[model samples]
Target: MSSNAELHTLKQRTDNYAYVLRCRETGLCAVIDASEPDSVLELLARIDGRLSLILNTHHHPDHTAANPELVARTGAPVLAAPWSGHAGSGPDITLKDGDPIILGRLRGTVLATPGHTLSDLCFWFEADRLLFTGDTLFSMGCGRLFEGTARQMWASLTRLRALPADTLVLCGHDYTLGNIAFARSLDPHNAALLEWEATVRARKAVGALPPHPTLGLEARANPFLRADDPDIQKSLDMPGADPSDVFAEIRRRKDHFTA
Candidate 1:
């Protein structure tokens, strides 16, 4: 099915991102990761949309700090994972992996990706070819295992990797430049990575939002997703190592990576 959803991207709170999704058919709207109420409210007003649902990817303050205010302002019900520890208004309807999210004619699927936080849930609007990854998968990087194990993180990433190559990735944070730097350090000879780095630099120089990379580009360029690649394993001096172990090592390197 093709998408009947209109996506509006809003940059909020420094590096964080909040998305507004509107169903074109029924005019129903939903906000993903309502991080900043003022910005989200302004956009909603500009778009003349009545917020129907406030979707939370995780319980992190940067991702959900405005949940209560948004709910109060728009009377929109919150939808989140059962374990989501949202600050004020709790989830009106809890979601799980494979659960369907309906916004008018647009349908999305909830993907349980518990790497950044055990409660992390990504929304995949297959018809639209959009994946809203909340800190679980970045452009050229993945989230650090703050509350979960490396193995768990790897497993979560694997699930995302299985998505369609053309799917556009919308991440929670704009850490693309830093992630690119890290990716280049590992895969210096990757033409795709090099080309992407130039594109990102150009966009950043113009103060534009980082380009939203496709899953196919990520599979070829992102070292985190390429943990099973022989080149990545060899670069880490862990040839023939388990993919999980390779992912763990990459995550470890990224944690301390300054450049």
Candidate 2:
């Protein structure tokens, strides 16, 4: 069966954020996170579809700054978590765990995968095999412990990893190269890290975008996710064999590394 739906992604480097557009051949379309309203509008204008809705992963300003303006422009419904405190006058739709939004030709299920923030929500498009991870799950790493616990974040990421192998991850930022750098420090012998870094550099040099909507299988090659690997545990001086613990310790190291 051929899908009439097509996914459009437009990224910006200023804050390393991205906005996604999902368009069905039925002249209807929806966007995920309007980080940059102007850029989003430009793309929307070019695409031959009706702007139907705006999907938000979290209440973070960087991710939602342009929501008001975009909503005004398109008169689309703003979908977010009930706890986000982001109810705009432009018609708010609060979503909870297990709540699915059925926009006629399009459908998306919401997951309360909090960790980066208490109100963080990730959306899973079963048909597209795409996960809008917001800031919780990054390219090679995960989000900071700003409003949630390491345990919570770990659990959230685990749930994401449990998805289908073909799922395409449309994360909030383009932190691939930077993440690979830290991955190398944590796992010096990881050939995958080296190769991934090389690929990132090549893309940047050519002024081309790195392959995003990263596949689930590729992330398993990431050291942050392979917390059970003996070499990774040894490098971090973490003695546990649990993947969750390994992931938590890696987060601490990354926080300290940045500090």
Candidate 3:
């Protein structure tokens, strides 16, 4: 199989799971979450387009640390949710639900996804069939239960999963290795997960990032997505209950994942 690079100036700095997206032809790019100062500037300088927008998935520093500096350097328009006050963002353009934007020749639309945070949003480039999942949804798992409930995250994941299967998911970070490791723990017997782990390990071994752009169907096989599946409830020592309740319990277990 061949690699298809979606955005021309797309680069991922795994330091804090931060990714940068810039349009090549226009010299106009949007930094998804700027973490490392030099790394982001290096990519920005290399790109032909001028920096026109800096977007923050949420107010996390690792994702927003370079926002002020990037904005100052390029005088680019900083766009973020209305409530993500002082993510070092101070975006000139505040985006809300259903807002459509034209970046260079690409059309970008905002989906007000608020599971990770009340103001978190995802950017969708319909023509290109690219969806930036941010911290909301990962290749194998979902975000933490920070400001929202399991129900909200569940709904958000469902909505995103509903997008066309071909929609390329450009999530915020490269947490694939770690996330898959956790997934393996829950369903150690899942052959699909075992096979995935082997491939991801090989990729990471070769210094190749393994942030899989998995289709919605592939994720369905993941126990994490089956937050409400009856089989999942059985594994969690519960059965015959509301899906939301099952989801909440699963999130509680995940909260203790790193521990």
Residues 53-86, candidate 2: write the lDDT tens digits. Answer: 7888887777777888878898988888854345
Per lDDT, the best of the predicted structures is 1
How well does each candidate superpose onto the true structure, as a TM-score? Answer: 0.96, 0.89, 0.86
TM-score-wise, the better of 2 and 3 is 2
Backbone clashes in candidate 3 total: 4
> Per-residue lDDT for 116-232 in model 3, tens only?
887778887776777777788776667787788777877877677777777767677766767777776676677777777788789779976664566553455556567667767
List pairs with backbone clashes in candidate 2. Answer: none
Where model 2 places Cα greater than 4 Å from the true spot, the runs are 84-91, 213-215
> Between 1 and 2, whose lDDT is larger?
1
TM-score winner: 1
Per-residue lDDT tens digits of candidate 1, residues 1-259?
2657788889998899999999877778999986789988898888778789899888788888888888888898989987534355468899899999988888899999997888789999998999999899999998878789888888998899999999999999999989999998898889999999999999989988888999999999999998899999999999999999999999999989999
lDDT of each: 0.89, 0.74, 0.69
Location of the lowest summed lDDT over 10 successive residues in candidate 3: 1-10
